[model samples]
Target chain A: MKDWKGKNLIFIGGGIAMPPIRCAIWYALENRADYGNITIVYGARTVGDLVFVDELDQWAQKERTSVIQCVDPGGETPEWKHEIGLIPHVIERSNIPAENSVALVVGPPIMIRFTLPVLDKMGMAKKDIYTSLENRMKCGIGKCGRCNCGPVYVCKEGPIFSFEQLSQLPSDY
Target chain B: MSDVIAKDDLLRLVDQWLAEGKRVLGPVKAGDGVILYAPLAASSQLVLEGFVHAANSIKEAVFPRSETIYTYKFNGHEIELSDVDPDSTQCIVIGARPCDAASLPVLDHLFNWDYKDKFYNARRAATTVVTVACSEYDDNCFCTSVGLGPAAEQGSDAMLLKAPDGWYEVRAVTDKGTALFNGKTTPAPEIKVPISDGPAKKFDTVDIETFLKNNYESDAWRDITMRCLGCGACAYNCPTCHCFDIVDEGDAAGGRRVKNWDSCQFGQFTVHASGHNPRAVQAQRQRQRIQHKFRIYPEKFGAILCTGCGTCTRNCPVSLGVLNTLEAIAAVARGSIEVK
Candidate 1:
């Protein structure tokens, strides 16, 4: 993230995956001048499933920040002002600029699986797309040995990995 | 010329160490015809022969099956926590197999890799390993395949090789060894203990590694490991399988947080709280054990996690140890077996 100065920072998060994405957005917005633009495409099963609703509105009010909220089809209510579709389809229709941008995606496996191709088609480099992973972990250090994806132990090496880094590992996790 | 110690003198030395309060661990005959590496209550309890290998490795010297890391006590709206002191008893592990001794160095990397484990390091510092060179090996022994041998001095402080007529040739490889046996050996220039060439190379490590690197999705994993009962006997008995679980065994009153040995072969080893399991099936778990020992650990720590001890196979209920799996992988790499 530090290497890509002035690059557009795009955050895509699904239900209950907002904490990490929310963290990155807060840091980027805290130093808004250091980045080019900030875009948050957040979705859940329904509006009731969304979190930090007021904070999302607050972030949308900030300069150069755009917050897009959505829900799955048929999950929206009568007053639903946002889009209605799966996260990947909504992202495709959002015209999110992939050039000179780093995307941080967080969600369940299904959300990640469908969103990657959309980001790729939008011209996001694999190295620029990051996601955090979770595995059964006991000792947060590397010794316990259960959290490994391949040669790397997620506890010590990372829970956050770029698509480029993750692609090299066996799909064990 | 070799420094020789009579078998009687060696047993006496063990008695002397026990009298001096140093913990002496060696292979002992447990009931039911099982020989295990256990703490010696007396020198007479040590079993010197008739066992190909102890049922357990000497890993318990540094990494015990279960240990308390810390304790907690609940106070009025507060909690009091106390750290457990790691056992620092001056310890000597005598009569360890060369394969068992070699696991120490391999394990050292994991304990000290980035976050230094104080407990493991403290015990390791206090323990000195005395290995006995194997004059005999069984079909399960494959130390040679993994670049180790019967008399390999990788982690032994001192080594004992069988000599003529109830004597052992003492070879001290470290200062610790020299100090322990400083005045215990008699010089016998004419005696040379013949060492057995360890078990024949069972599988090529390079070929096995190559196959593992390429065959993550192969159907061979399912076929090869179909009979694995997931009993985890192989892991529990393995010298280098160091996975563990940390649990807090307490309620509102407070209790201790302990670390216990865990096994990859267990179905719950990699299950997430959300009920998503990465390596969901038995085959995947078996593949993980092999890949971890051969490829992943070596790639990360520059050492193979296995010493080719073969205890896993010897203890495995289904006869599906790493050797059998690796041999199958080797055949697959050589194109002798086809996987759809």
Candidate 2:
């Protein structure tokens, strides 16, 4: 319930990390009176693999926040009224203003890579986009040298960094 | 800061530091004409008269090759996790080459930006670097091209220069270095040095971004990378090549989380569980390696990631040096194709 007034946050992918992202989203939702719109654009390879479907449905039902679910058109799923396509396609069609939006992109590197250009086309600066990096985090505090991308260790320095920071590294992550 | 420390007093300084119950890590011969940063038990252990850079950078002292991140235990179908200890130790790295020391700050920028990493930061904070100037430059060396020189002091707390009459000129650059000079440290004698202009080898990385963008799919990579063995010796030895992976291991009862080194040359680097890979070919992987260093990193930090240390060129099994790659790409962009 900490004040997030006038802040627009979005999460663009769904994986095992969805529950944690939901917890973060709900934390923002509790203070909707103080925060701006919170949107979760959950994309999965198929409808079945999309975890937390029921919970997201409940949130969308009460209109606590907006949820956009995109699945492969060929993938099986019960009838769902959300968008069906790639997450990047959904993002482009959602008409979200990139200038005022702070996106938290977490997924495989390929998915993260595909979403960046769309955000860039939507006018989001590299600094406005944050993504968590996964590496060999031998020492979470940055000593083991396993999780370092360049100057940053994904574990200690960040599991989170602006795309700008990641762009500086040699893609070791 | 105070006056410099003379070369002759180097051993006396080490003796004093050891007497004070402090440890000193310096370059020592480790066989196969290689040098490693190891503990100095005596003044003879220090190789001050050498012109070669250490085979490996001193990153291992701060970030070890392997360490436990967290421990976990399984109970029936459930699992529990426990935290590992943070690494914090005081030490001194002596006789680091200018190129190696200079890489520290660039590495620091990424590790300390958002979340503070205590592991590497703790060692970086606790460790005091003493860099030595390189008296000789080889064909593979390109420190001058990347804003670092054989004599650069980019990341040192104190710098050591070899002067005539077997004397060394040491300058303290940081508060930590100044503190080292205040207690039990004496000024080093000055030595005469010759004025020199231009390096033995020079490179112009101007407009590298545009050059790389235009040559992304050029045949130069395929032509040059044919001899590559896919071994990551270059990355493992390069001072600035930092990449790793994390994994959890143990039985159903308990296990530990560990982090270990990984390389872009591996087949699984960009592999996904769903059987998709972006850099499945050697050509793409090589491109990823070079672009990340020259194009991407420069665009991010406003500086090139490669320090031109030449470690990669020297250590590669088939000698797929980054210099050749840079030259090839640049040549192609300039409307020519050449590898020499």
Candidate 3:
């Protein structure tokens, strides 16, 4: 509800999280003028596994949203021109500046680990990259110790966190 | 005068509370030596001398294991959202163990810290916690080591202590508890013997952090967690272990996103939709479970998220108690390589 007005947002990673991320993105893109340009670079193992494919295409048609789907090599796909390489390579080839743009990373843990270094390579400091973790959470509130990744419950302190915050915690996270 | 209540008088007070329409729930003897918390309709329902902690914590009465948070409907292309308000009944939880009551305050910090979680805070605000001190101890019990006493003021608004000759010491520590005896009250009964407070139980958790940090790739994890079935019983039964999953269930016309308790021990917890799981192996999941409680929780919240309540130990299908895990790590820290 706050003025996300004038912030360029990008979501990297694809999964069950994609729908929720898209839900939030749609909310932002609805207020596009309020929220600056929105772009989503979604990565998955294959094109068959991409979530919200049609929805992403429709949003990109309006130019209010742009989506790049990354698939593994030799993965099944119908020819639609988008970023075709792995996530890190796509980021390297694409000229998306990391200085001011907010990037949301949501994917498997290995993807999370691999992407952080790319952000580091691009000189993207921790704060600019936001990621959401899906730890086994029961109580969205912190009372249940189930979602604990140390001091923060992934449910309460965040399903959303910065790379800087994640870096400080123990590696088990 | 305000501290002591005879056994009959104590029962009458509970009856009076229930008579005044307050919901009273206490520990009940469930099947197979399991103690569960349920509504106590009569004085005889109270278990004044139970040993182990309840099968589940009193948190369920407040923060249920599963509850709907919100509902969303897709109408054509637009979406409509609705809020889920928690139940607004005043409930009293009696016969809560010391560890169970103590664990609530630790949970309060994250619930009310940044964003105001109305669901948790609402139930917490409405409910009065009555903690019963432990008369017996187990080797797995470590409440004393973690800044808690057998009879401690961790989270109880009012604490009930059983004294000799069928007398109970009723001490009011919070305003709501004090208000229970505001008007013209009957005189408190005298006790025959002073309450017994036991010595602190000691365990060497002294380098738990260092051990975990240094032994990231140790084979000990695999050996210890080999018997884990990943059933999540340990998480489900714990008093302080609160993790959850939010899922949207329903048709396009209307549906609800309900949150249910989740466990890190399960492979599905961190599995992406692409069918790739981060913690596919149980060792990684087991490591996560331990570090999250000991190292990570303290790192973020300045308090270890465990009360050493031994619920996990008592209920584990494989007998891989978290206490033994900590002890193993501490033993390794002390340079003992003998595998248990």
Candidate 4:
């Protein structure tokens, strides 16, 4: 793993994936010295679809952190200044430096499917890119036997995985 | 303290337990071809022959299919909640198959993981399962492959092996098992534990587990796919499959919460309120069923989830048997089948 103290923590996500990555943001803030620059690149289909509105505003001002919020290109308003488009294009415009850094993407399947390759294209190693998965689960624990991604149970093994780890999983989701 | 008893004496033991004011449950012929573990009103209702297994497992006696978790009532200005207590029910499961009895301990590990499921645990505490060795075996039986046999006694309180004669060779496997028959037995001929010749021990599942772990995109899955009617019979009839859904029933302000049996085969199973469905296709749903039983579960808990009872195959509308799929996967792992 890259050194979080000097490396950038880039969060590229949207929709329901907001809260969990936001959780990581709060966590990094709790231990500011161990982490470097934290950038959150969030998007939604529309403006109202955004979540944790006040927290986003709060993190926007926090030191060593940057918050980039966007909606679909068509969702742009007259007052909006931030680039509005698909998250990957907007992230490409941000000129993110992938060296010695890790990128976390938490979003719908389409967002994950599109965003991860873009990071890969930008020279992010398979190990440095991570994503969260969603599945139907009867038991939050490993019991009721649903929430499986191939041989791995999403409930127990993970709802989280690195790009390299996910490549080894069956594409059931 | 001799432990073996004749069939007549076993029936008498049931009669005695009933006389002692305890509920006795056993597999009874439910219909023309159906058999179920039901509460026995008379000793004659107990059907110990035909090792083809019952229509249901002994799980429902403890974890019922559909049960009201709690009730809520309208009090003048506000609604009140009432939690159901699990200390009242007492039951004895008679004539459980070794596989059926074994599923309880598997369920026990799950229900008591981090947060104890009080209702299941309470009923588990109150119930004593009595498993009987098989007198026969069918083509679909595979209890031996998953590390259990007709006489394997992992979860039985008391195990009774049927001798060539009408009597059963009894042995206690636990403290509760010993308590089931303390002074009720007579000295009899010593017998070896009987093993079922069903579920030929030839089908090795080790390679299948490893293959599934390494190859997520194995074409073996497509080969096993048949035209499924999407009915939940496989999960519904399975002894080890216990997925459930919590639903609110009754009127507003005075409704009760219920736990209903759920199946992963349903399209609505993985759908989100935000209109996102992860497993939107039938193949994904079907894959989950196999992975849960053979792969995900064993890797995490070190116990094969499927008891190889063949209930899923017997209940499948499309004749998509689990054993065939497993064998095919094993073949793929062995390099017998070329990956496409």
Of 3 and 4, the candidate ahead on DockQ is 4
lDDT, ranked from best to worst: 1, 4, 3, 2
Cα lDDT of model 3 by residue, A77-127, tens digit: 777456576787777777766655677888766677777778777877787
Reference-based lDDT, residue A114, model 3: 79
Q: How well is each residue in A1-173 modelled by candidate 2, as lDDT tens digits? A: 24335767777765555866776777776766765667788878777778988888786764536878888677645776667887788889998856566788887776777887788788888887888765544435543333445445466568887888877655554
Report the lDDT tens digits of candidate 3 across residue range B145-222: 566767787788877777777766777778877776455234465543344454355564447877776676688888
CAPRI grade of model 3: acceptable
Among all windows of 10 consecutive residues in model 2 chain B, the one with the lowest summed lDDT is B189-198
Q: lDDT: which candidate is best? A: 1
**lDDT for each residue of candidate 1 in B104-217, tens digit (9 for 90 to 100):** 999999999889999999999999999999988998999999999999999999999988799999999999999999999999999998888888889888888888888889
Off by over 4 Å in 1: A1-4, A73-81
Q: Kindly report which residue stretches of model 2 are placed more than 4 angstroms away from their true locations once superposed.
A: A1-173, B1-8, B19-23, B73-80, B183-198, B338-340
Residue range A43-63, candidate 4, lDDT tens digits: 998877888878888988989
lDDT for each residue of candidate 1 in A29-103, tens digit (9 for 90 to 100)? 877888988899999999899989899999999998899999999889999999999999999999888888999
Candidate 3 segments whose C-alpha is farther than 4 A from its true place: A1-173, B71-80, B181-200, B204-206, B213-217, B338-340
Docking class of 1: medium
Fnat per model, in the order given? 0.82, 0.12, 0.45, 0.47
**Which of candidates 1 and 2 is the stronger one according to DockQ?**
1
Best by DockQ: 1
Q: What is the interface RMSD of candidate 2, in Å?
A: 6.1
Model 1 residue A65 distance off true place after TM-score fit, in angstroms? 3.1
lDDT of each: 0.91, 0.71, 0.73, 0.78
Please give the lDDT score at residue B289 for candidate 2. 77
